[model samples]
Target: MPYAKLTITVPDAVWIGELSRAYPETRFRVLAATADVATGVARIEITGEEPEAISEDIRDYDTVTDLTVFESDERMRRVQVETTVPLLMTSLQNSGVPLEMPFEVCDGEMAFEATIPQQNLSKFGETLDGMGISYRVDRIQQDVESDPLLTDRQEWLLDEAIERGYYDTPRRTTLVDLADELDIAKSTCSEILHRAEERVLKDYMGDEKGARPTVAVSSD
Candidate 1:
């Protein structure tokens, strides 16, 4: 499957955009969003320099007729906010893309990273267009390696490695550091990394003859 990271900006005419503009200084990270036939709610984890002010502002928002805190600390606060933006979530959910974690909402844009079929890419875009939402594709990963070449665990580790700057020129972390972070032995981490690299290189160089790629489902 191919994966893409997209950032969608809601128009100012929309309720969510209005709220975002109202609270320009507050950062709202949507943890989860769900909708029913008539109503929708979004669990937002908010964090900013001024927790008290941010909390007050959220309470003042008319759109969030109901708001309740889940947790609060010095740096971050979580809350369930009744939203008028459930339609946006529903649109994406029905777009035939398997949403991955780490969904984000900050400023006036919602950022989503998901695994999608290459063929459905156009359909996904069309869905957004049908909803009148503006968006941009931040990144895309096409299948350069054979399917199942790396186990889910291996793929996760690779993602972590790239995120933590392990592949940087100066190297943000050593293999030992990565192992410590993963709570695994350095040797095991090394083995997994080496094997993953070998498989990826072989596939990229077209050395794996008779390799078959998985067909992805259409967005429709």
Candidate 2:
């Protein structure tokens, strides 16, 4: 398998791209999306100071036939909409690459991480190019099947840590914060994350010397 991370600049003609450019500060997290031959549906979490206004704007797009707000607050709004299929998504479908869901779009760019068949990598790139979708491959690595690499709890905790930026440079969140969020003891959280990280690193690096550098999971 091949694992890749891609950043794509959405064309302004697309509704989501136009909206992202209009409100550069807003973050659109597409939690779920599906498309068929005639229509597409997307469930998005819009986060910003004026999510209400943004939701209103989404309803006004000609391609959006229906928009339903499921939740709203001062900083975020969750909405589902029926609209035309996005070209980027169509390209992915054509390329036979499965997208990892819950991707983010901000400042007119969308980020995607996917694990695909080794033979499909070039086809994926070609499909994107053919659709006129501008994209940059952030990274591509040979990967093994990851499903059996970690326990379910370990995998869930790792996802939480990454989503909260616990692994980011300079560290946006601390181990203590993560533990608090998960309602677990700090030591337990650290232990689980450490074990998960070790398993992932070992699987990825194998016998490559110096490839498995220590990761400090604690920022207390």
Candidate 3:
């Protein structure tokens, strides 16, 4: 829930080993040590949830001096943990939260999240229910609006088109139908709507153009 910074004196060698073994996830970097290098104070920034949430690690550092914790639980929660992948699509195909593989090992210190489209979320939920799997949807489909390139008018037109099922496989609404409803020329509507649609799909595809850059590591 919050990041905590703890100040404490480094205990004896035995205690140090015990603390390390005890808190596997707690990172203990040496901010500074004693002049003799045995009884110096150190700052231990625990990067995780609240102290109570992750209290098991806190207990080990009972002897830490100037014991203080500084962090904002609210500020931590405000961070938008946006995911680049289509979570629901992946969940449906994979059948669950695949925490491994390309999902990759995340930093224990960082916030975690998943973003899924509304339709995919609903489908995934129904699948889970059908399979008798116990799960809950904690969030809603974040409606990502079309990019800045589209004017407000064009964005509204495109959104209405999608809502009216104009993009459906069966062609739920024809260009003539939309024109009649909006009392506008089909050509003008089509151009605006197409531009809006392109922007939305572009953002969804992770980029409007070109491939993501690759990193090449040198042996040196």
The candidate scoring highest on TM-score is 2
As for lDDT, the candidate ahead, 1 or 3, is: 1
- For model 2, the local distance difference test gives 0.89
Give the clashing residue pairs of candidate 2, or none.
none
What is each predicted model's overall lDDT from 0 to 1?
Answer: 0.76, 0.89, 0.45
The sequence of per-residue lDDT tens digits that candidate 3 reaches over residues 1-220 is 1111211122223333344445545443323222222232333334344433333343344443333444435212111111122222233354332221112111221112344444544564565466443443334434565447678798788878888889899989999899779889989888887778787787767662456676789999
The stretch of ten residues in a row with the least summed lDDT in candidate 3 is 74-83
Per-residue lDDT of model 1, residues 1-220, tens digit only: 7888888886765555656666666677777777754467877777766655576666775555788888998768888777554667677766766655446666788777777687677788998899898999999987565559888878888888988889999999999999999899999999999888888888776854456575789999
- Comparing 2 with 3 on TM-score, the higher-scoring candidate is 2
Error of 2 at 106 (Å): 0.4
Off by over 4 Å in 3: 1-149, 205-220
The candidates, ranked best first by lDDT, are 2, 1, 3
**In terms of TM-score, which candidate is stronger, 1 or 2?**
2
Please list the Cα RMSD from the true structure of every candidate, rounded to 1 decimal place: 11.7, 10.2, 21.7
TM-score of each: 0.60, 0.67, 0.28
lDDT of 2 by residue, 1-220 (tens): 8889889898877789999999999999999988765688889999997999999999998888999999999999999988885665677777888777899999999998888887788898888888888999899998865458899999999999999999999999999999999899999999999999999998777866566777779879
Worst 10 residues of 1 by lDDT: 13-22
Off by over 4 Å in 1: 13-15, 145-220
> What is the Å distance of residue 57 in model 1 from its true position?
3.1
lDDT of 1 at 5: 81
